[model samples]
Target: MTRRPSLAGRLSRALAACVALALIVMVVASTLVMRSWMLANMDSELHRLSQRAGERLDVEDAPDDEVDTDDDSNEESDDDSDDDSDDDGARTTLQSSGRAPRPGGPLVPGGPKGHGFGGAGIAEGTLQYVSEDGEAAGAVVSNFSVTYLNAPALAILAAVPADGGMHTVRLKGMGTFRVTARVVEGKTVLVGIPMDSIDDVVLMLVGVEIGLSLVVAIAAGFAGRAWVRRELRPLGVVRAAAADIASRDLADESGNLTRVGEETTAGPVEVADVAGALNSMIDAVEDGMERRARSEAKVRQFVADASHELRTPLASVQGYAQLARRDIGEASRTQALERISSEGARMASLVEEMLTLARLDGNRALTCDRVDVIPVILDALSDAHVVAPDHAWELGEAVDAPVLGDESALRQILTNLLANARVHTPAGTRVVVSVLRSRDEAVAASAAPRGPAKGGGSATGAQASSMITIRVADDGPGIPADIRDRVFDRFVRGDSSRTRDGRGSSGLGMSIVESLARAMGGSVRLVDSEKGTVIDVTLPAA
Candidate 1:
């Protein structure tokens, strides 16, 4: 089973952090903006109140009775006007900044309201204003403390520059406040408004934002889980199909596990494409396997036919040899003994070739090792001389030819080629075995049919090449153009009707050569030649 990453685990963790961070930013920003708006409103209101009070002051409409016109004429209306101005300022202070008189209490305790601009205020925590000279301007002692002004809300107040617009002040140990101080007539006019309403709104906004973030995170996690499952469904189907196909051996004629099911297309594109492609590949493999099975059945029938034909001649030869041995006549005994030996050898050769073909048809592993081609050819020629005494065997100069192959199989290849030449060539015919390094000739030998001439009889002096080739040629009746390709097949011969008279030649030599060459990761084929049959054996050099 294939293990996949958990979608919920990844999505949930990622979304939680993202949503929480976003909500925090939103809360902080909204709170700051709301607090600023509230302070601006309060500052505007205080400015309007000051302007109204300034507009109400009248210079010309001074009380005539209250201003004493003195006998000293130089003390003009200006002197009386200044005295009237001082009185109006004191009364305005008592009305605006003075605390409401307590019942049965003395009013304006500081010597009966002698003031130009004096105000009373409630001080709490860090909410205190300093004048341009840096001295405390308003009330000195109250609920707030100036030392502890580092809280987040209090930091917002400290952030406001002394020269900037109206801003709110939040004390660490006291409630938030909106404070504005401006210079009026060379004195600071300070006004403060509390920010409780704005604070409540900000708190509400924060709660709503956090709740929405949580909802979004939860919804996203659920959606991701649903999407992942839907996307992986087709892959699951494909996985099951592959597992079933691998476990089944469909070579049995019964069509049991051949069918693969189609899946729905409501998933990811990659999964759908994989399933479609896998099904097509499997179908093609199954068809090819079925065709191979039919071909193997045909090969078995052919083998049975060939075995019957070979066994009959052997049985007859053996019976005659037994009778001749029992009679004890010299001539009869000699002929029977010769027939028996020839028949037995022929049968053995046929059996050996047949077994080689059978090995090729089965799952046989070839043992490949480094073998020197030049020496192997020399050894094969020495063996061939005994078998073909009448034919003039010429051994050419040996070249350094190395190959990776089974040594026994390489020798068999040489034996088959020499035996083929001996069987086809006439007595006293010249047979040449040349060893040289030729790149094109080696390639052409493995690609084309065997010829009776060495590399098309064009003795292009040996060229330096990567591969080594050994050509065995004979000046005999060359194979016809049409049957040359089939010469390497089992039971096929140059002249099929002219059966050998028990000389151990069953037309299986070339077949053994073909099979052996293939097992060594090489091949044997006819080289184009004009004169006689020439078989070139090419092997890779070490």
Candidate 2:
């Protein structure tokens, strides 16, 4: 399998490719521009030389001075004289510029040969003179041993319209040249300059551009690699941190774990954002892990406690069953049978409560309906009074408190709270069951003395707008201060020794109340009381 490039590597390659492309484009464009300018200048120079050749031919073709007797002849002779004078003047101008007149023409003051206009190596110009009737007049070759009047080159030169504009032609024996033809004195004059110099310059420029482009591309690659690596250093730190975390067993109890610090999370905004997000995720994961561990521990303890609670009743039932099976007298057998039945019923009740808690833990949806909690509280109070008539169970001023909840779950919550109060309190303790239609604020105020209710309903701004609360308060010894916070925890009994009313209490009563209340979109919390425990159940008012 091929190894894919990393972020830094990809970034570096991309940057280097961009730089190389830009340099290539710039170099190509500049070379093209330079070549165009040089070629244009060369053409201009060729045109100038062609124009000079045309002018020189004009001077050479001028008629000579002479006289005639007839009127027509004299007219022609006079015209010839004027032409001769013009030729003399033009030749004198040329001579003044250090160029001698034609081969047989008169000489004028200037420098010697090989020094000025007639000098060798002065210009690589090949001149050809052609007559109007399509015949070559003469040719002049400079800076070379042989004349460039090859048939192919001559044909190309003769094809020009003598328009004084530059054109390009390739001489069979002379490579390429820029040539221009012009009509002068009944003949066409062609002037050309070899293209070797321009070609050489273009070649040299290409070589330089290619060399520079390679150097720049290589340099950019290295620099981009280094810069990209540095810029992405924070990403590497984040990656390492994640990998380190992944390598560790998060389930371990030890809280010592590596975390990315501000230094690594403080770079570029995007990288910083990623680092911050990673840190937050790790923190949340750690928190969740802790909560999960605590939940598991609680579950384990609950199972152990439940087993212990069931074991005693089971043992008693087993002992009584074995005793009943013996040949005892009728009276003794009947008592043993009764004890067996009682122990069996207790164990069944405990098992049922455990099942209920398991169902609640499974997040079973509760029945949603408009329930009048006032009636539920009254019924619970009546039952509690029946169960413990020694305790003064009084019902507070009843109110029509309608709420949305599961009717059975609501009744169960009330039953548990009232039972917990009656069983835990001393005889003659006034156990008050009340129903009140109030807002969250009023409930909070009344519950303030209790330092907030444990496992209480957390209402949204909208839900807290109104609520229905059921209070089960007793005037017996209130819950111990030490266990107040964990009153709703599973298997937590008011008596830490797990004994209540001279028997082992299941310790799941309060836990069941809180779970049922919450499942019904409500909450159960212990309220502060001066004498005895006050349990309040709050639900969203319908």
Candidate 3:
């Protein structure tokens, strides 16, 4: 199966693009700067060379009678002389002895100005001069007095100048150049220089730029992949941990995953937060598992206890009925009939208690009525006194202690607490029930007692005008600390062996009390009894 791209992949791609773009920009900028610097240096060198060549073309004296009208600052009569010849095969005027030196004389003194005798001076067959007026007698001379260039430089030189216009040219086998000139004193001096060096430098720089761009692209791609991997490592851990968890593993207390553990919280903030969420889910799952287990166990135990409680009476009734049917005397029939009636009555009582538990489990809507909490406690105590005359029962009342709930559930809760106190304690143990307004002792009993040994029999009770609390405690052994929190679970009595109670105590009493109190928006809890287990019942004030 094709997997979808992860965040890491996308992030790496984006980072790579950014890095590549930045590198490209830098390379282009550097290349342009290098090319410009190289070109400028070449141009400066060319200009310097041209200046030196122009210096060499100057003459020592001015020609007379052909005064350059453009500027006449130098005007002197020549005494006598004729040496150089013009293109017409005519002898041209040379510098005479008496002629004044012209202003702006020779750019440099003593420079060559001539045509070859019987042949024109052309450097290496490339540099040549042609006149504008026309060649005279197989000779070409420009109107400008002087011109010079290197024929070997022709291949690298620019295009030949047109009259007075500057032009650039690329020679046949050399690089490009610029050739230019302006007429000075009725003479034209052309200068040209090769640009091969500058062109070579530019080409080299272009190559470097392209190479750097490729290198940068490669480097960015590798860096992007590494960065993506580093950033995504945490998320990978989360995925693996999640996959390891399963439904069956939810109840394994030792292996269960929770957010509060060091492993989950030890990482980066994002990972820690994710771990915390997982821990919360784990906690909820564990609690649900515990509750479900208790519920199922209670259901099974209930079925067993009901069978045991009703079976004895049911069997008795069946036997008595059978005996009555087979008897011939009225006395035997009447005696069997009496035994049947007594068994039926016992079954009836057991049924009533079972029905009460069922009602509590169904979480039916409760009836709200103002009940004096003191009276409720006294009533429960009075019933306990009658049920087990062997145990001592004590009661306390709080002034104006009132509550709102189903009167019957409250009565049952108190009855169950007293009954638990009776069953868990030995005969003649003092069972104190106290009720008081704003009594701190009663409030302390809302928490679970430590245990049957260290935590039992130390239960206390307290009360507030706005909330009523009652405690039923004994002097016998209390609940164990380890299982104290679980005592309120359905069908979970302090004793487990069915043989301990030939008529086993149905463990749903505490469960019924807890469920009923919660349904009525109140709470029932165990407290540390002075010598035995103490239970505290709290309800909303009327």
Would you list the rank order by TM-score, best first? 2, 3, 1
TM-score of each: 0.55, 0.81, 0.56
Q: Name the runs in model 2 displaced over 4 angstroms.
A: 5-7, 58-122, 126-131, 137-148, 438-463, 496-504
lDDT of 3 at 112: 51
Candidate 2 C-alpha lDDT tens digits along 1-542: 99987877788788879988998898889888988998899888777776666555432331122110112222223455665542221111222223344432222224233321223332544544454433343233444322324334445666776788877777555677777777777766666677778889888988898898888888888899998788788888899988988888888832655677898788988889999999888888888988898889988998898888888888888999999999999999999999888788778888999999999989899888999776776787788778888988788866785888898988778777777876677788998877776544533312122234444443343345577778877889899888888888777788765446444567888888877777776666676656778777777787
lDDT of 3 by residue, 319-417 (tens): 989988894699999998987886777577568767877876786788989877777777787888888899898864455667777788888888877
Ranking by lDDT: 2, 1, 3
**CA RMSD of each candidate after superposition:** 13.1, 9.5, 11.2
Error of 1 at 26 (Å): 5.1
**lDDT winner between candidates 1 and 2:** 2
* Full-model lDDT for every candidate: 0.58, 0.68, 0.57
